[model samples]
Target: MSRIAESFKNGKAFIGFVTGGDPSLEKSEEFILEMVRGGADLVEIGIPFSDPIAEGVVIQEANIRALSAGATVDKIFDLVASLRKRTEVPLVFLTYLNPVFNYGFSRFFQRCADLGVDGIIIPDLPYEEKGELAEIAAGFGVDVISLIAPTSEQRIKQIAQEATGFIYVVSSMGVTGMRSEIQTDLKAILEVVKGVSSIPTAVGFGINTPKQAGEIAKITDGVIVGSAIVKIIEKHGENAGPYIYDYVQSMKNAVKELD
Candidate 1:
């Protein structure tokens, strides 16, 4: 079974985040290992871009640092190729359209498939842009996941239709960041996506605490914690792994309540 589908069948939501090239390639790999050990059912390795418009301050800075360190598309594949040896959890690439275009969509997907990546989350490439890439992805058995905002039911359903892996449901109206509380009618949003798509749905944006993760897990197939995990890495640098472990464990413990 696909790692993502297998996790949902086990009656647990998944936790995914984007950590492309952090302080260094070595540290980035360490961070991923920590996230896995911390109860992440899937990991989104973002290939650092020159301009990450969808990201907030925390991740923007990380991208800059990674770019400065020369984290390229080739480097990211190499990192994933190496990581494939140790980790078996689903690995999804979160990237922008420009990089994919630059790398040649066919070549990019082929390399990722060769390296054992299970899925991809390209924020800028909306459902309208899913012609060639989607075909390329499907041929390799890689799911091309899509995202939706809280405001657009029409757009949400359209995005969900194209979503091969889990549909990423943005919990808020703004760009990605950590927030104190989730939107009030999150359950309704999840239901909206659920009503349209047979695939699993995972919510992200502004999800910070274990309490929030628990609450979100109650509604969707999974909760994605990005800014919170980024904050841990920002605060502790190399010691970020332990923080990731603790925080992920808290969310996992919370999910256990539902099971």
Candidate 2:
């Protein structure tokens, strides 16, 4: 099985995301290791972009902080290279298309292959336009993960059928952030995806607390927490490692309970 597929094979996956170089690249690596130590099955590292259209206030601020701290594409690649030496956990890039375009798709995916990145999530890349990078990414064995929002009514089937890695089921309609409640009829969406494809589905966007994680895990194969983790880092800055480990451990335990 692909590394991404293997992540969901044992049980419900707890996928964690953090903005790369948020506090600093070193801290980014530290936080990721902590997440793995805390039982995260997969990790999504955001390559800071100037205009992250899919991000909310928390992550947008994180992007700015990372950029200001000099988080370049090269630097992020180096970060992944260093991470590969320490862990084999699946590492996926959550980035916009512009940077990949600027970096050259072939060169970018080649680096990903070389550095042990298993998959990528491009929020801005539409399903139809995925061909722009999908073909190249596939050549290098990188899965271009697909996202399905509640608004993806008829297209959900189409997207799921073609999806390579696990499908990212967006819990709400808006951008990424924490929310008190996610009333998007997610089970209905998962039903559609399951009908067409056996690929694992993970719900993300606005998922924070263990209660929410457990509730969502009951319905989906996994739960993805981003803004919540980023919030922890934002509050703790360079010292967010142990806090991240604790939070992720709690979240993972919540998901594992469903198993």
Each candidate: what lDDT? 0.82, 0.96
TM-score of each candidate structure, all chains considered together: 0.95, 0.99
lDDT by residue (1-259, candidate 2, tens digit) is 8889899999999999999999999999999999999999999999999999999999999999999999999999999999999998899999999999999999999999999999999999988888969999999999999999999998999999999889999999889999999999999999999999999999999999999999999999999999999999999999999999999999999999999
- As for model 1, its CA RMSD to the true structure in angstroms is 1.4
The digit string of per-residue lDDT tens for model 1 on 55-149 reads 99988888888898889999999989888999998898888889989999889889988999888888888677688888988998888887877
**Candidate 2 clash total?**
0
Tell me, what's the RMSD of every candidate? Answer: 1.4, 0.6
Query: For model 2, how big is the CA root-mean-square deviation?
Result: 0.6
Error of 1 at 17 (Å): 1.6
**Runs in model 2 with CA error above 4 Å?**
none
